[model samples]
Target: MFWSKKNGNKSQEFQEILKLRSELSFKGIQFDKALFQLLTPLFEENPLLFKDWKDLQNKVLQAVEEKTWTIQDEIEFIESYVNLWKIAKSDELHTQLTIKGNQQDIQIFPLITFGAIQNALQLGYNSMREHPLKIRIQLSQSTLQLEVSNRVNHYLQNQADNMQFEYWKNRLEYRYPEKHQLFVNSNSNIFKSTLILQIA
Candidate 1:
């Protein structure tokens, strides 16, 4: 009985280690994808312009290792992709940002939040026509809300997009089982997603 109990504890510990490693790996991949999306266009257009890509990459990796990010970090991260969108889509893309409450040094899960931002950007780009792509972020004492919306053709609203959003929603739920809420809605001409995280 003693040996069985010991082995059971060991097995449980091993499983936990594996789960931690898997989550870390997923976080790394998500960050890399977001970085790639932000840098690929600049690299293609003028490689020399992003001579610091490797350095920026290292900074991002370090941030992931630390597992916490400040409000400035989050804003900078989102703006990177927004800048890329401006370069790639030009006149077709329009973005607005509104920040409220105190955000000076608030800490957040950069990997999870940024992953959702990347997903939203891709969805908007894929479905957007002449209408502007809109992103709104609100920071308050108790909640962080991110909303992304874009006008799309009625036919573009399909199951694949919902599945993609679901994937991110699931990740958020896993990361913050009791602290986050996600909502996605699509109508004949518009697709919108909102993610709200309760600050601890």
Candidate 2:
């Protein structure tokens, strides 16, 4: 809703959104049954809940019902994930997403970026008092590159160094074998991770 109001949607892009929205609405988790019956009435009072429901379908629940993921979906998922926390702690954030290359052509795993983003928010001060959080993405050829940087507390520095992010490593290896690389590193005031995924 806010996206359309803020940026006038081109005819093609608008139609694409409407079409995907329609498919996702009708394709999975029938509202006629148990889960729907439990949550229907609350939707009217809590608008954000409704929004989360849709995002949950696209960003999470769809793993069972769908096999395809567009770059736009990934971008929106990242934005939505951050915005929830940002809304609650707006003053504590100095974060931004810097995207490059062609978003439309890249195919990515939904929620693949979640682990890195979560760690950034947790390990970093993420406020005016510290250096800003950097969420950067770039696509070149058949590979996708992601890097997240944060300013963290000195006492918690050990925790940052110990993070293995094995979930991501295992998944990426299973999907792309040696084609992908994932790792995390930190120095005194900054902690960061870099992931290069081949997602052709």
Candidate 3:
């Protein structure tokens, strides 16, 4: 009787292990499918995506090495990224940009700012229903700010968006430590993100 119970326990353990492996395999397949869906549009429509990204990467590296980066450079990058979205979803996405302030010589981490803008664009695009997406950029001697807003059919706020905003916040904290302040807030109807870098 003891031997039979021990064998049964071993069989149960083996079954549990098999079940865990099957679960992991199913999750892996789900992840792959999600990734394929996310990338299919870029592959099918925007064959130039890689080339454009490479060019932008080079420009960013050059700016960082030369220390000649400006706000306009960042604006252009954002415009290009928005343009890609426009090309991809021309009828679904509408964008308006308003840039204010005259300070253009302020040095900054263009990539970090770009990441923040990308997050903003994602939030805006996802929330935009029938209204146009609006982006406002303000530059000053001491601060730079960007505000993105749009209307949605339903309020579908996700932690992923907040996490993206926090990703940049943590990055800024690590890089600027004491010289920067990052704030991101969302509402039932509108999503807004603001980044202020203190350049004295």
**Best candidate per TM-score, number?**
1
Residue 80's C-alpha lDDT in candidate 1? 63
Candidate 1: the clashing residue pairs are: none
Point to the candidate with the largest lDDT: 2
lDDT tens digits, residues 1-200, model 3? 45688899997886565445433332332122332344456765666764765465455445542133677777786676667656556467777888999855776655546444555445554424456677787888887776666653243555234544444555565555688766656656655556677755
Q: Look at candidate 1 and tell me the lDDT of residue 79.
A: 70
| 1 or 3, greater by TM-score | 1
Candidate 2, residues 77-130: lDDT per residue as tens digits? 677656655644547777878999888767665556655776676556778644
How much is the lDDT of residue 98 in candidate 3?
88
Query: Per-model C-alpha lDDT, please?
Result: 0.63, 0.63, 0.57
TM-score of 1: 0.71
Candidate 1 residue-wise lDDT, 86-130, digit = tens: 655556557665666678767876655654455545555543345
